[model samples]
Target: MARAYGFVEYGGPETQQLFDTPVPSPGPGQLLVAVRAAGVNPADWKVRSGRRTGSVTVHFPAVLGREVAGVVEAAGPDTGFRPGDAVFGATAEGYGGYAEYTLVDARAAALVPESAPFEVAATLPVAAGTAFDIVEHLEIVDADTVLVLGAGGGVGSATTQLAHAAGAAVLGVTSAGKRELVESCGGMWIESGDGFDARVAATAERCGAVTAVVDLVGGDVLERAVALTRAPERVVSVADPARAEELGGSGITRRRTREVFEHVAALVERGVLTPRVERTFPLTEAGAALELVESGHAGGKIVVTVP
Candidate 1:
């Protein structure tokens, strides 16, 4: 039996419970990981709260984590991975990441850098992957002034790094507390408040023209990005699609995002990119971690560590 973080109801972190389950065997094309860490994203809360829908909508009680890093404990038939290889990747269907063991596609998982910690490598799947997708997929390059709304968060932080790597002039919007955080990723920051528009306009004015907008903040923030964009197609968001559509934007498709992940993984291997992890919780404390992530004030990322 394996212990995991599960929830019987859709609520905040308090609803999550530690439970037992049979350690699942990897099926064909799958690798079973002895999970060291799991990256906690806002999507975990949204899907659990029923705001986001996907192929693995919970029918029974479910786990709610996504990205995971650990060692390959077992490989299913024809899997290329061998036992004891350190790996990391995005987990699909149910939140198996909040456990000591979970199954992921062998092809999708990347071998971790020998020098990186399991905790840091664990942060890459969604944040780094999505950042790579947005910058590369959009072809943001030299002299491009890319506005990163909500740049203090994981995806936003990672996006800033990727955009800077391509010589884009990145501008980040964040609360005052996060100014240093965004700047470390090579972006200038705007504190979100009453004067947000003025701050944005000033930032744009200095950059000459806004070529792209990667909004981590949806709702009114997307509208702000829309107003700032001189090229609509270059504007992108990883937020609510319904909200995105209301502003004449669309969601990032899965296939294209894969290319971004592959490109970023190379940067990670070269030691040029680092995923900033804000906090780590035990698998049993997933509930508390979710609360922090949902509070919209996490310094960077929250990860769940399993023994």
Candidate 2:
């Protein structure tokens, strides 16, 4: 039997417990990864806390992690991967990853650099996918200025890097502590505080004009992004879809997921992008990882380690 993390109830991180289950097998166009690391995200804690509920229509055991990196243990005939290929990507339907072994769709999994550790590769997929998708699909022009809310988070950071690399002036809203990190991503920092709008305006003025905004923060912060967008059509929101729509911003859930996966895979391979995994916990301590994500204060990803 393989040890994995699952939750039968929704409350908080403490509800997560490890269980023994048979290892999963690869099916057609599928892969079985000997999970080395499973990165944590807000979605992990949100799902656990029942705060962002759904995907639980059927009553069955639920695997809490979605992104993973590992060596390919096996692949179905339709998949081109070899037994030893190092792969990283998101799991389908949020079923697994906090386990020693998990199944991933061949399309979702991409070959990663062998030199890179499992923990780092595992940090890709979700945030990078979301960031890459929105920035590419929106087609932010060279002269356009892009805004990223919650620049301190995983998705926000990735968006900042991808957009800046694409030639857009990135204005990132974040805490004072993350200024250096965001700057490294080529983003102009906007601290989240009383003068947040003024800061963004100043950055836009300095850049001559703003264009698209790939907003990762929700609530009032997202509203602030809506204010700086030079063109209404250039606005794309990765988080806070409801608020984004209310402010005439388009949603990125349509293309960013797949786009993020593809773009980040290339970036990680070419050494153009990097994922910061603040900490890693053993599979047995998956609950602690979720607790850190729940706090919404982790500087980088909190990954779950496996065999």
Candidate 3:
């Protein structure tokens, strides 16, 4: 039996619990991984709370977590991975990374380099990968001034760093507590909250017009961020796609390919991007790790380590 943390139904934190189940086996083109670490994101709790209704059906007692790093205990046919290989990627059969063992689609998985730890590699698949997609899709250039909403979180911080490295001037909107974190990523910190657009506008008056808005926070925050940019088409969001589309912007389309994983991993290995893991919890404390992310106060990434 494998120990896993998951929700019994679509509900709040009360729905989450730790339980035991048969160790999942890899199907064709999948790998059975002994999970080393799992990265916590807002999506996990959102999916659990039923805020993200979609075509995907939820099986009761569904395990959460999208990305993970671990050792390959078994590999399915034609997966190219061997037992004992270190790997990280999105889970295959449901986002079930919150388990002692889970399956990963080989196509989406990447071998972890010796230089990077499992905890750090675990964050690459979702957080860093999404940031890379946003930067590429927006065609962010050095001349561009990009406004990053929710700059203190995982995807936000990675997006800020990638945009900054691309030569774009970044105006990061976050809480005053994460001011240093935003600035350290080569962004000019703009405190987030009510009247956020005003502060952004004042900052843009000095930096230049915001050519693109990479929104990690949706709702009114995204609506306001869109107003700052002239090229609303260049505005992209990960948090609220429907609203983004309604506002003339679009949601990020992920390229769940091995190449993207490799590129992001390379950047991390080179120290050009940092995962900025704020906290880690053991498998038993997975709920606490997720609570931090769901609260929207997490400074960077929160990961769950399985022992």
* lDDT (Cα, 0-100) at 246 in candidate 2: 74
How many times do residue backbones clash in model 1?
Answer: 0
Cα lDDT of all candidates, in order? 0.80, 0.77, 0.91
Q: Is candidate 2 or candidate 3 better by lDDT?
A: 3
Q: Name the candidate, 1 or 2, with the larger lDDT value.
A: 1
| Ranking of models by lDDT | 3, 1, 2
Best by TM-score: 3
- Residue by residue across 1-307, what tens digits does model 3's lDDT show? 9999999999899999999878988889999999999999888998899976684456778888989999999999999999999999999856489999999999999999668889988999999999999999999999999999999888989999999999999999999999999999999999999999999999899989999999888999999899988999998988888999999999999998888998988898888898888889999999999998888889989999999
TM-score for each candidate, following the candidate numbering: 0.94, 0.91, 0.97
- TM-score quality measure for candidate 3: 0.97
Candidate 1, 50: how far from true, in Å?
A: 2.2
lDDT, candidate 3, residue 208? 97
Best by lDDT: 3
List ranges where model 2 is wrong by over 4 Å: 51-53, 56-60, 254-263
Q: Write the per-residue lDDT of candidate 1 for residues 177-226, one digit (tens) a residue.
A: 98998999899888886678678888788775788888788887688678
Question: Could you tell me how far off, in angstroms, the CA of residue 249 lies in candidate 1 after the best superposition?
Answer: 3.1
